[model samples]
Target: MNPSASKIQNPETTVPKTPQMNERDFINDQLTTEKYMTNSYNIALNEASNQALYQDLATIFKETQDCQRNLYNLMFKNGWYAVEQAEQTKVQQTYQQFTGYKSQLPYSVQ
Candidate 1:
């Protein structure tokens, strides 16, 4: 007759079963989580009003970014991930494209 007891003993409520996870699965999950964390930190960093908070978030963001990069390197070394190298010409073109925007800035170098 108790409401709490009924809720606790509800037959429709079910817990999710844990799936089998391996090393690659764990690394992939960790890498994905860290990437999300860095993205969230970036948004928070942009919206932070206090300088101290901004600096703290910036440091944490950098650390998370480094950790994510390290995980990527590990996966790459283990052949778990395949990363293609950019051609030198493509790299040079991209560099030139970005550098072309320097003249669009409002500030002029004296």
Candidate 2:
């Protein structure tokens, strides 16, 4: 075996390249992961049998949620995320559709 070829084939001899993530992608990835963690924390809080554990998890969940929100706001401010404003007519139509279905519910609301 050639020495130069062996060096090329050896994984340990090769330099490990770090993943290149753009600012937008980095922030988006962090926000997505935090949102997922927040959801998991919510589930844990709901199933928590110990009050102390529940309180601790609730605090962490709120913090994670806030972090996620902050990331989203930053991205929005930087124009990384585009949000479209809904038309008033479309909003009214959605409201009417839900209200119509609400009347068909089995439980009566006073």
Candidate 3:
């Protein structure tokens, strides 16, 4: 781990390590499924030609995305998921680097 990067997480809630799947394992599996569903839905939405089909998929996509976020939150709350806090200087540098590419785009960026 980088010295400047700190973990944003709660204390881990203990889980069983038996042959059977535990709560964390089930949630993690669901979270992974939701992520895959969302990605597939996005691609489908992009290629969908019929308006009705597109609308249906769009709704499902939104729901899947929300579920994915909820699962992530649950995992984070239980310390099953941990995110690294980006150093402000590194974040600023990345922002600047991406922003510098705005001028290279054909259309004007606001």
Candidate 4:
């Protein structure tokens, strides 16, 4: 099979090449910022000492995550984001590999 056959992408929306930033550049920058914020919020959430602070961070984290998702969706809709379709065999192999390690876990998964 052709390697590119599994690529799942829409026709790219073109943007004019210019010194100034375009719509794609602006959105991409915001997306990058959102991603960084989410990561920071995640770390803060993990090490939060106070219950109230934790809750506040959690809310903010969720909002940031939602915003990130929205940005991702917008980029995808505009054909700025492209994802590759995973091969079924490779997916199944990964699944089986992980499943085989279940017995090594301290707690039961089921």
Best by lDDT: 3
Instruction: Please give, for residues 13-34, the per-residue lDDT of candidate 2 as tens digits.
Output: 2223467776766888998999
RMSD of each: 17.2, 15.8, 1.3, 2.0
**Global fold similarity of model 1 (TM-score):** 0.71
Better of 1 and 4 by lDDT: 4
lDDT of 3 by residue, 28-106 (tens): 9999999999999999999999999999999999999999999999999999999899999999999999898876787
Shift in Å, residue 2, candidate 1: 67
Q: How accurate is candidate 3 locally (lDDT)?
A: 0.96
Measured with C-alpha atoms, the lDDT of residue 65 in candidate 1 is: 99
lDDT of 1 at 28: 78
lDDT pick, better of 1 and 3:
3
Q: In lDDT terms, how accurate is model 4?
A: 0.92
How far out, in Å, is residue 46 in model 3?
0.8
lDDT of 4 by residue, 1-110 (tens): 55755766778889989999999999999999999999999999999999999999999999999999999998998899988888788889999998879867878563
lDDT of 1 by residue, 1-110 (tens): 43333221212222234687756678879999999999999999999999999999999999999999998876666666664555667789999997878767767651
Give TM-scores for every candidate, taking all chains together and pairing residue i with residue i: 0.71, 0.67, 0.93, 0.90
Task: Itemize residue pairs with steric clashes in candidate 2.
Answer: none
Q: Candidate 2, overall lDDT?
A: 0.77
